[model samples]
Target: MRTQEGDKTVELFLSDEGDEVVIEVADQGCGVPEALREKIFEQGVSTRTDEPGEHGIGLYLIASYVGRCGGVITLEDNDPCGTLFSLFLPKVKKNDDRTINPIDR
Candidate 1:
């Protein structure tokens, strides 16, 4: 929740959509510029100008793991402020799995 007097906060939500698990992590911090959005996923592209040990490889690690799991990851601008990282992972099924597996694109 957001209020006019308070600062933006962090939020996380997990949901199941048909056969995929949708994961969303959002924050109310300064938003990422459109030009640097994809670049942030690359190493040595840190948004933290004031902090040390700022290697922009955290997202890259997550993305690599997600890729190995056959999942799709995306980043988008969050309303009001902040960035949204959304992941759609294939639902693991036991016995007989019926959902279509996500293809890496």
Candidate 2:
């Protein structure tokens, strides 16, 4: 996964096996503590200071969207120091004429 400070680094990996796609995002900023990992995904939960226009909904949104898409999202510690977010998405199948053939009647 990519690593950055202000911005998030996203890495997409496609598995040759089953329909599984893994996306990893790593940040070089302050890493997440194991204690708050579960709570971080809750709505309005934030490590940042409360500001006039700051509402903590980042991880909440990420978890929600990923769940709706039939995927799983998890948070882990990045080596040295940082936060790593991983998302797993199931592959979708498409049916086309080229993928099927008509049998003789």
Candidate 3:
């Protein structure tokens, strides 16, 4: 992870394990409070106004879309401070019968 400005840092990781691929985005900012952790994915829920045009839909949309793709999303504490978002996506191998219909969405 590399620090950007101030004490902020962002990190991304990707790995493949078994039948799924994992993606993690970690940030060293004000960590999500324990009280609001479960409600963070709700629409219009936000804690920080530091970023420009942060509509608070990123998590909500991520959860929604990941769910539609039969994947899982999780959040974890990033040690001293910050949050880690982990996304697990099931691989769709070639000739796989599982079809993802985006138009029906």
Best by lDDT: 3
Give one digit per residue, the lDDT tens place, for model 1 in 64-96. Answer: 777767798898889978889999998776876
Question: All candidates' TM-scores?
Answer: 0.75, 0.69, 0.79
Q: Give each model's whole-structure lDDT.
A: 0.79, 0.70, 0.83
* lDDT (Cα) of model 1: 0.79
Query: Any idea what lDDT model 3 has?
Result: 0.83
Between candidates 2 and 3, the lDDT winner: 3
- C-alpha positional error of residue 43 in candidate 3 after TM-score superposition, expressed in Å: 1.2
Candidate 1 or 3, higher TM-score? Answer: 3
Ranking by lDDT: 3, 1, 2
Residue 6's lDDT in candidate 1: 78
The order by descending TM-score is 3, 1, 2
| Candidate 1 residue pairs in backbone clash | none
Stretches of candidate 1 exceeding 4 Å from the true structure: 1-8, 95-105
TM-score of 3: 0.79
Question: Residue-wise lDDT of candidate 3 within 1-105, one digit each (tens)?
Answer: 345546577899999999999999998878888887898888777766666776667788888778878999999999888899999999988888877555242
